[model samples]
Target: METRRVIFFLFDQVHLMDLAGAVTVFYESGCCGQPYELRYVSPYPQAGVSCGLSFTNLEPLEAVTITSSDILMLAGMDLSKWNHADDMKWIPWVQAAAATGATVCSVCTAAFALAVAGLLDGRPCTTHWGYTAALQEHFPKAQVLENRLFVQSDNIFTSAGISTGIDLALYLVEQDHGPAFAYKVAKDMVIYIRRDGAATQQSVHLQHRQHINHQVHQVQDYIAHHLPEKITIDDLAALVFSSSRNLTRLFKTVTGITIGQYIKELRQEKALQLLKEGHKLSWVAQSSGISSQGELRLLAKQAGRGRLA
Candidate 1:
């Protein structure tokens, strides 16, 4: 078997979780035990990567002249301070690397780097939810999705914040090894194998309401306002002056998901964002109105896994 070279591009202020999660997932899957080579490369050779807490092994990017690699991964970086000079400096190199037919990926806010390099233009991609609006504003040609855990179009993959990188890695593990192997790896890791973008975010309540009829909107709004309450579809429909059947169809059409699915997704997403913000897992579930811890785990799993390539 030919070994696949996976290069992780790192920089200062890179999110340590994003890089380490991916490395851990791939390493634990036994891919590194066989035909898989993983290495860390940086813009400056020998400069240690200060990811949150500790230094990470990093090689210089300029040290290698070859553009060919099985995969190139751009780890999370704080792009708020990124400059045009930085873009001009690496565009040619990035473009050349992509021309080699290697799969390219970005984790969390690292999608900003890919977009600045013009690699995400017209591609279906995602980034950390906090940056989704800015990413769309910066790269209008790119279709930016805020609620997705990851988006895979062509050979380029972009995932949401932090731990979502592990999901993306596990997704790749599934593609290369098969579902059974992927399941085993996920099981061993005590992680979920299936995740989806049907998950929610802050603007989801208003977003869904705006797309549907006024009655449907009222019901959705009511649901959002009363999430902790035991509100049913029938109850929601009555509040909207409609039958449950009509409400269900409208909900599905407007959001491309059933009412229950939408509610669950919204609750899950909020729970996750809260958890990432350092809210205790127990508190996140309680505050988000999700009753079950197992349910939260399933949602986290759903929010983590993304497209497989």
Candidate 2:
């Protein structure tokens, strides 16, 4: 495993959860075969944080060097005074860091800082739900997304509110490692892996888990990981140790969707993820169990997402 430095950009009166939640995710990944050097650097040497405690033992912002493999995380902060006397220093540093290919990320109100550095311009980014309009009004160039749990446009990532920072951090871990490892991290943290996007855009890993059926959960997990293979109702029934008739009826009752529909949606979700990552259409079809390009397009179109690719 490669060692990656995950640096947190600290400031005075910063939201503690915004910083700590993501820090916990990266720090805990070390136990799971992912080596990460977690560092904290601040514009000031030390300052008071939102949790009524001071953030101490911090290095100055100019002390460390930035690299392409480094991850810079800016947590939520008081944005009203963002432009006050700090212009000549950190903004240019942030711009240069992004130019150097470091992945720039923000949680909640820190989107304003990224916007000030002009990183979010023409990129789809999100902030706390209440501040989306203000961000768009102030920085008209940024494509501000309102209802996203988080948005990832290339290397720049932004999330909504404090808790979603953990979601984004888990996502970052997933990108570096893999879904299975990320899921392990989430399981260890005792939190759900609420994958990227809000509402209807939720990842397949989380979307169908609203029910309390263990058998259905197992079936869904199997279907998701085996998207490229053919799965029959008999396979699921045997896996759950039930008759085909009983399993089919119970699956629909528990998940509110039939087994076939669940499999199809899982494949569609895989196809959409592949498409978003710029894979070729044929590969998307094959990897997502869509049979062919024509079938993939037809499924997406029927789902009310025309020209999905």
Candidate 3:
């Protein structure tokens, strides 16, 4: 097989795993060993590459051209804070790259970047769940999938958050090589699950939390804003024009947890943040709406801080 170039477009606040996971999977598969070349490219030569945070040393995208690459991957980022001025500059280059017949792809929030280039318009695409609603708002013409891990429409591909980049890479491997080769690479990487796009993103939700009512999200938001309030299912249902039972079902679907469990988890997740910021366990409990330090300790234990003593 002839050597093919895989260029990664890195930028300030770029998601690190989106680039690392894809590059690592392909490199470890021996795809890069025989006929593949992997390179990191960024728009700013001095700005450097950071995975939504800080960085060390990275090359500039200007140093390379996507025209020469077999695959051009636009790593994901925070779409809410994305500026069109900074992003629009790359549209012409991306459009040109796509015209070259090279596969252009995005992982998570990177899908928004691809959409900016007009390449993803009228195509099936996806991004990180946190930004799915925003993606739809921006690209009304594009069919932005919500539940899938990734979507491949023609030569353009888009994936969900963080680890899904690996899944996208494996799909690419299967396309460029074969299923057997892709499987071998997955095995070497110790990846036991290669989730298809249809896999639900709500896997983290416990069974007790699987409600599907619209009011659930509304109630959750309300609870989040009023953490000090003592909320109940009935109180939440009253706000949504639905009965308690119906609200519970909807809550479970939207949040993947019952109202009580979602509240507890949200409180606990917030407690940990407070604790790390030097808040005492008792203070964390009070601020997080829990009753006692003992309950806080238990929540901490459930959060995997059991060793905190």
Q: How many backbone clashes does candidate 3 have?
A: 14
Q: What is the lDDT of residue 191 in candidate 2?
A: 76
| lDDT (Cα, tens digit) per residue for candidate 2, span 115-180 | 988899899999999999999999999999877889988889899979999989988898888877
Model 1, global lDDT: 0.71
TM-score of each: 0.59, 0.78, 0.59
Q: Which residue window of length 10 is worst by lDDT in model 3? A: 201-210
lDDT against the true structure, each candidate: 0.71, 0.83, 0.71
Model 1, TM vs. native: 0.59
Candidate 3 versus the native: TM-score? 0.59
Judging by TM-score, tell me the better candidate of 2 and 3. 2
Q: Candidate 2: lDDT of 265?
A: 79
Which tens-of-lDDT digit does each residue in 174-275 have in candidate 3?
777765566556656766435563543222222222333334435655776676568888888898888999887777666556778778776766776676
What is candidate 2's CA lDDT for residue 253? Answer: 91
Give the top-scoring candidate (TM-score).
2
Q: Give residue 58's lDDT in candidate 1 (0 to 100).
A: 63
